[model samples]
Target: MFGPEGPSLRELAVQALSSVEHGYDLLAPKFDRTPFRTSGRVLDAVARALAPLGPFDDGLDLCCGTGAGVRVLAGLCRRAAVGVDFSAGMLDVARHQVRAADGPAIGWVRGDARALPFTAAFDLVVSFGAFGHFLPRELPGLFARVHSVLRPGGRFAFPLPAPAPASDPLFWTLLGFDAVMRVRNALWWPRFVMYYRTFRLGTVSAELARAGFTTELRALPEFGRRADGSPRVRLVVATKPTTQQGS
Candidate 1:
């Protein structure tokens, strides 16, 4: 629906009718062509912001999806960069998309984010545009999963845009989309779960805190400030405490 190479409307309809996992599996090959892939501009801004926070040894890109975030990791991290996703097709694209000069070796692992397979292995972790696939109730478990993979004092980060107000057309557009998806799920099996408004800042911060990470938001100046002077984009930086033992 985005460009000549992007999926057509009929193909999108077929995807929307499938379960979330299966839908992504079906869409994986052309996913990067669609507008859904995180943009190069956003990726560059994120990498620039994260550079000061690094010298990180290893980094992981959760729900990597065609390796957009993996590129960011390859630039920020020194030793290795890994991309994890459930779709093999997506991983295939990532394997090819991530061939830059000499840097951390790029690795792709096919796995679900809810049950990641690692323990204190990554010094930094990042995700982009995949949160809507996760329902709010899953945040605790998901955050815990991320926590288990990060080294102590390591940060799990992502960029979050401020919610659109009711006055904005984007607000109603997202609301309508969520409502339609709910109806689609009610009539369909193996539900697809993606909602725009579900993961607000307050709920996310609380979940991160519950999962044992102290979280903060860092504004990305590259995206520029909004009309009211608030940042257009902010990075949610959640840090696992240095001492894992009971405080």
Candidate 2:
């Protein structure tokens, strides 16, 4: 699903063999051209979903590769929007690619998601298509970092796609992808940690609660529904409570 402007197969092989940071650095230049980039449709849908709850002041885009999520923040946040990631190369492209002349001021920082550099600095935080890099066991610490960066009553929001049913080809596709990743990590160093099946809604909600966020899910109707009337995707909005008793 890569375009001509995307990385070559050889280039992708090199990246897959490298550490996550170095791999992203090598892929950063052509990232937006690849399917790895968060789709504009998804971004627009998220922006629409988040608009009612916001008029937010400052926003942060955690694990913001190429700053696609920052564009959403610029529309919803009034003051400033900052994108943070570990890849300097991605930030470099973001610096040159993402700009808002009249909206919120955009800035980029090189940092890890596990240990963010800010404390209660953001009123809203959003991430897109980056969670697979983190293993299930890491969710607690990662959510805690997001919680620490957000002011009380602030939100950490992201779109969560519904899992494919067993009858669907995508189900097998993702299952196989995760299996390959597991095998590869078992046999390789500097593990490239991308898995499709590990992040489940129940587990994520529990972790967010442990991190002091009251979690809720809003259906994104644009993606329509399954035969069972379940939403195809949802926006997970986890808010840090305003008071000790969870308000």
Give the number of the best model, judged by TM-score: 2
What ranges in model 1 sit over 4 Å off?
A: 245-247
State TM-scores per candidate: 0.96, 0.98
Where in model 2 is the C-alpha error above 4 Å?
Answer: none
- Every candidate's lDDT: 0.90, 0.94
Candidate 2 TM-score, true structure as reference: 0.98
lDDT string for model 1 (166-188, tens) is: 88899999999999989988998
By lDDT, who's the top model here? 2
Q: Any idea what lDDT model 2 has? A: 0.94
The residue-by-residue lDDT of candidate 2 on 1-247, one tens digit each, is 9888899999999999888999999999999999889999999999999999987999999999999999899999999999999999999999999987999889899999999999899999999989999999999999999999999899999999999999999999999999988998999998999888998999999999999899999999889999999999999999998887833
